[model samples]
Target chain A: MANFLVWVVWLGAAFACLVSALAVVSFRNPFYSALALIGNLASLAVLFLLLSGEFVAAGQVLVYGGAVMVMFLFVIAYLGDKSEESPWSGGPSWQIVGAVLAGGAILAEVIVVVGLKAGDFLSSPKPVTRDFGSPAALGRLFLTDHLLAFEVTSIVLLVAAVGGVVLGAHARQGEDPTEVHART
Target chain B: MRGPDIQWYVILSAILFSVGALGVMLRRSPLIILLSVEIMLNAANLLLIAFSRLHGREDGQIFAISVMAVAASEVVVGLGMIVAMGRRHVDLDVDKLRTLRG
Candidate 1:
């Protein structure tokens, strides 16, 4: 029964992930695409939980679903309706065909590789310690084994924050911000 | 109880990545392109966590966390550029923004 329950949840989350991913790409409106991305991220968090990644799963929800997505929503809203894209208006027909063909080719190639070469090794789950994915374990690894990466990530975030503010200020100074808002 | 096979997760991630790639290729909107990039990143994150499970290690999760931070920063800067373009009344179409074309 326990095994059956795990399979059920896995199937559901996988299906949700696929559906929301499609919705994210196919939605004509950027706002709807953003909303679909939130769903995709949430379903992915569920998948992370099933993979025994407790800390990663929680971070997925808190960071991607909450903070990052909210920022996307704000930008979409701020941009107003001008952000909407007419379906395949600017690009030529050949570009669309090429894109679909390339996407299908990538999907087929990955499936073949995973199916043939790595199938056996990846078919079973490895045994894990009781505290395998606990926040404490992750924190220890972050501070010790991956200390430089962790610190570097913080510096990158700071630089990005400063860059965003500088660009925003420059944009505002280029024109009357009120004029843009009024036009929108 | 055993869970579903790791291959299943990997295949799912691949599909998600392909869909994201298609989105980036087919869409003209910068916002949608950014959103598709997020999808691609999340797809990669899914694979990382799955492999982390397969190897019984925490290293992949650490990498996934780093990817998340980088993704957030990318989005912030990209959106700022988009806003700047909007203020200039530049058309949001990516194909027309080719001022650097030789």
Candidate 2:
């Protein structure tokens, strides 16, 4: 019974992904495309839950489906009433090639993942950690075991944030703050 | 009824992941392409979770959560750049954006 449900969830998630992919291409509206992708993302979270990675599932819901999708929608909202239907045309051939190559890669990945006999890893409902989902064990490792790398990543994000501000900033002919700042 | 194991979940994740990859390649819109990448990242998270469940390791979920954070950061910066590019040149053809492509 449980296995059947797992299959049902897995198949549902896969179907959602497939449909969303088609929508990404077929949709005339970019907003609709992003919306469809959210469906795909939500299904992934469900898949995570079924796999017993509750933390990951939560992250998927909070981060991907929630925050990221909102960001995309925000971008779209900012573009509201722009009255431009931005026709997307550059190369259909490239899309076809990409589809083929991507399809092949997925097929290969499926073979590898499925061929790895799952019986090797029993499903015992064992805690993922000594204290599953405990904030302490996870917290210590994030700040300690991976401390240096984590700090480095923070620096990288800082740089990226600054770069975003610089790159996205637009000034009028006689009102360039960046230029004034540079002069200073 | 035997529950589907990690392998099934992984395989399913891979299938969804491929769909995302296809979305990335096929879409002309940079926004859609970015969304596709996000989808791919989600698929990877699922894969990590599957492995964790199979191997009896909660650390896998932890790792996936961190990865999702990194992915979030990446999307913000990347979309900011893409949006900037779009603003400068109404056309967001990535192929055209490649001035550095020798």
**Model 2 lDDT tens row, B11-90:** 76676677677767766667767777877877777777677676666667777877777777777887787666555444
Between which residue pairs do clashes occur in model 2? A1-B1, A128-B58
Q: How good is model 2 by TM-score? A: 0.77
Candidate 1 residues lying further than 4 Å off, grouped into runs, are: A170-184
DockQ of 1: 0.65
> Cα lDDT of all candidates, in order?
0.89, 0.67
Indicate the DockQ of the complex predicted as candidate 2. Answer: 0.46
Highest DockQ: give the candidate number: 1
TM-score, candidate number 1: 0.93
Location of the lowest summed lDDT over 10 successive residues in candidate 2 chain A? A80-89
lDDT of 1 by residue, A80-154 (tens): 988988765668889999999999999999999888867568876678988888999999999999999999999
- Please identify model 2 stretches exceeding 4 Å from their true place: A1-14, A80-95, A116-131, A134-137, A148-153, A172-184, B95-102
